[model samples]
Target chain A: MKPSSPLGARFRTAVLTLSLAVVATLGSVSRADVPVREEPQRPSAFGATEDAPLPTVAPGDLQGLLRNCDAERERAVAAQKLCEQDKTGVDFLGAAYAALWIILMAFFALVAIRQRRLSAELATLRERLARLGER
Target chain B: MSASSPDADLQPARPGVTWMPYVVAAALLVALFLVFFVAPRERTMGEVQRIFYFHVASAFAALIGWVGCAVASLAYLFLSARQGMEVIAKITDRLAHALGEIGVLFGTIVLITGPLWAKPVWKTYWTWEPRLVLMMLTQFLFIGYLVLRAYAKKDVAGRKLAAGIAVIGGPAVYLIHVAVELWGGNHPQVVSGQGGGLQHPDMQLTFAVAIASVLLFAASLVHLRMRHHAFTDELEDAYLELSDREDARS
Candidate 1:
């Protein structure tokens, strides 16, 4: 597609950004299963789930496999929890922002009203003085 | 005909005959409509996610004001063209204040709606994560900038002092990202550290468009704000001159 329109460029950028992100996430998981243990490690506790989907690596010792599954599950839960907390903080900040706008607009309107009133009053006084000068 | 001193009232806006305020008000309304109804709701967050439009847009405006402040300050520092730079500084300062106010407002919205959007998925509110922390710090620094400008009187010494702070404050504001990167939290920090992108094609496009629209609105708003500052300054000077005459009569 031509890169002329904003829509096209945005779409292109979005596609690139998304693909990169997916690769990054997948890459982390694939690379993280390092051989930290001297002996060959097995799947995690989550390995108990026969239906569980994981790398197609040949099954290893049952205990190690189970431990690996458990660790993966724990990581997933932790990540989700982190997202939740972040959301809350974002919410708090949002309300604070709205309140500020409300107060600011109200103050602005009030001042405008007050100034208009004073200006009108001053105008009226000037008119009175002009009439006295005519007399 | 407002003769109010620059720092006299820490007030919002006084009564004035001007089209810009209405323009701003109209632009704001248009922005609201376009953002909420026109722009498609997020695929990920759905309807509640609509708040992201104004929330992020306001933040973008603040960013514009920040950049403007830095530029105007620099012009003042380098050129020393008193009238032009001083005028620009005043206008940019006002823009900064206006945007800062809006930023605080939207920043808070991002926080509240953030959980509403997140709770469905994460089932929680509040986090110590880096993104959120950095966002909060950004809000705090703007608030400080506004308060500092207000407290600083309008004078040679005051302008120089404010200019000094602005030089330090401008770049310093972004350091919130650095601070956030230092700690643990689930904020995507790619540019700063964490993979900040969710990596969904649709999400990315929508986000970019949303941000662009908001930037346009801010650019227009700041332009009007700068003009308002110049006229308002002229009006105040006229009033001061009149006030001096009254003093002589008394």
Candidate 2:
């Protein structure tokens, strides 16, 4: 192509426009392929400067976080205490009922043993008396 | 068979009502069911309140035993001096002794169950409360009667003295019942007919069944003891007669 020809100049201009369009499309596709990361919003308690992120906790915020942690711990402890109380009540109830049954069974056993022994002794005495009568 | 014959005067009487044990067992099983499942958990005492059914039931059974003992004792004392009433008086004495022993057994159960219930509810096993003290005293009295009867000589005077002790202890049941009313105590008087009855029908039903079961059980035990006593007496008399005949022959 001639350096100053009108047709050559027109063809060069079209080629430059096509190259720019291809570059723009590739750039957009590459941008879409890469995931975008979103930064979390800082609380109002922190300073307003976005570039210089606060690296240390503020005094007031530290105390508030500690208080919240303490509250969570106390709630858990209270729940545990209630559970222990319920378990204790159940245990005592079982003990009381078991004691009653044991006492009753013991008494019944004593009576049964005594009655059996008495019957056996009576049988022996009757047998001996019958032999004596026969003699 | 002459009245003088050892078997004629001392034969054990057969029980007329034999179905009591079956009824008692059925009632007790129902009572256990109602107490554990049907009754509501108490507001403050929780599961410990279930003990109240049997505790009160045993107390009532003890009262029945003591009262029966007292009546039999009075009868024996009244009839022992009459002519040709020796056999009946002896029978009454045996009944009185049997009732006293069973009364002591029920009383022991009441004492044990009460302390067990109290421990969880009151945070202490025992305290010097009026109702508790009176109940303990009543228990001691019956225990004393049993000990005396066991150790005393087998004679009319000894029997009379033990019978007197029983008559005195019988009135203690009334005293124990009124002890809570007369003097304030921690014991709850739910079924006193005055006020503060059980709110739930299930609790009331369980209470009723427990009482019926304990009372019937006490009666059954008393009958067993009476029969045993009669047989023992008959055997002793037969041995004595046999010995006498051998002595005469020798």
Per-candidate TM-scores read 0.51, 0.73
RMSD of 2: 37.1
Off by over 4 Å in 1: A1-135, B1-53, B77-112, B115-124, B151-153, B177-184, B189-205, B247-250
Residues A16-113, candidate 1, lDDT per residue (tens digit)? 65457657855875776433322211111111111235544456677777877887887677556645544654454355446546755674575467
lDDT of 1 at A134: 62
Please give me the DockQ of candidate 2 compared with the native complex.
0.08
Alpha carbon RMSD to native, model 1: 17.2
- lDDT for each residue of candidate 1 in B143-236, tens digit (9 for 90 to 100): 5444454444344444444455455546644654355446645432322323344243444444556566556545554554444444444444
- What are the candidates' interface root-mean-square deviations? 16.7, 35.7
Please state the error at residue A16 of candidate 1 in Å: 49
Tens digits of lDDT, candidate 2, B1-250: 2325443343334554778777778878888888888877654455667788888888888888898898999999999989999989999999999999898898888888887777665666665678887787777777767766654435566678779988998778788888877886777766677655776666777778888787877888898788877766666667767677668766
Chain B TM-scores per candidate, in order, are 0.62, 0.90
Candidate 1, TM-score of its B chain: 0.62
